[model samples]
Target: MRALALASLLFFSAPPPAAAVAPPRDAYPDVARAYWVELDGKPLWAGQPDKRLPMASLAKLMTALLIAENADLAAKVTISRGAQQETGSRLGLRSGDTARAGDLLTATLVRSANDACRALADWRGGDQPRFVAMMNARAAKLGLRNTHFADACGHDAPTQYSSVRDLALLARAAMKQRAIVDAARLPSFRFRSGAGREYRMNNTNALIGRYEGARGLKTGYTPGAGRCLIALADREGHEVLAVLLHAPERWWDSIGLLELAFDEAKRRSRR
Candidate 1:
């Protein structure tokens, strides 16, 4: 009886053979190479969040933020030669062309217009360098430690870089602006140059229309950045934000991320 009791005690005290702990779920596929966080006011998931890469045109999201915060929307800004001639996805504004800051913002958010970004940045900080400084300052204030800015339009600047987490923070901040949110969801828009030529721009974020509860967000691409997207969606009374960086196929990756986020959100809600 004594030997049997000692054996039972040892069996119970040996940590029960150490029950296995399940591996954490991988929120993103390996091909997409992403970081995702689902928060019902708290972080529920994270993966490779600190990996920094070029944001491409997603940097314009911060550009729009600074413009909305510092410049008057209704205020008219004259395009400078630098702004008017900026390459890559332009709204075709002329050097002498003029438009309201509000309209330029719409172009920037909805179209990712490089020229519009330049014009807005120039208007806000009087030049690109000064505007970049302001962007870095704002990012610091927002606690985006892994982000840095070299240009407003996110053209190929050697120093321009941001992480998925930082982009998500920028997206959240940009969403607060009604104008930006509205512009981001727009399917299409038309803008006229000073010479009366109309230029039409479309929303680059494909997820906005096809995904349920999807709202305005941003898309970016460059050789160095690959494809990137920041997406926001609300499902079943829960709001989810997803960020993907260096994705080969941005739209598909965004959809997959959103689906996972919504699934997790729904499960948590039920619990």
Candidate 2:
């Protein structure tokens, strides 16, 4: 009984266990309102990925994808009066102007040109509403329950919204088309309209030609959508795709996330 009493006293006097040290911060901190990172087809990290939010001009990805899948690249698309009046990030196309379907797709994806996007939509669906219906239908087919589109060029709208997760899916589907992959990676695109006018535009994605291994993808911004991006990179046969929505510092955050994702992948491989 005396020995038991002594042991209990020692147990009570022993130093308490040290409090667990938390990491400096979350794996990602304030990266975005919604973000998702994937490496080699596996999820690496995500934050509020399924929360539907304004996508801005990233909606052009679906427009470009649908064009790649259904429209003949060589076909001519006549710019309508409505397409000419499209606001924000325009390719300066005028009414009665014509451009190749593929060129319009390139301008749409690379420059986030709303005029080019609306022209493509008009050519494909005969009207914006019809094209939006097709976009929603494609979203449904892809199982993107959290996505919907009220505009072809991603103007701020109450009904147009998509999640980071859904954007990732949409980006992947769009990248599968060679034309999209080609256009998105270009640093600049130049095309001519039927009115003998030339349109030269730089890619909206800043990473192109700057970040090593950075490839085709998309970027967007609007008053409501803030900054959005679908960034893709390939290194040593490994692919990393990241989606960011409403990120105040999308370029820096995207670079940081891609670096962290690749580092994490390397660590996993070592294990």
Candidate 1 achieves a global lDDT of 0.76
- The 10 consecutive residues of candidate 2 with the worst lDDT sum are 15-24
Which tens-of-lDDT digit does each residue in 185-207 have in candidate 1? Answer: 88888866556768787788887
TM-score of each: 0.86, 0.89
Angstrom error of the Cα, residue 109, model 2: value is: 0.7
Candidate 1: worst 10 consecutive residues by lDDT?
Answer: 15-24
- What lDDT tens digits, residue by residue, belong to model 2 across residues 158-251? 9999998889899889978999999999999898877779999998899999998999699999999999999999876789999999888788
Best by TM-score: 2
Residue pair clashes in candidate 1: none
Stretches > 4 Å off in candidate 2: 1-26
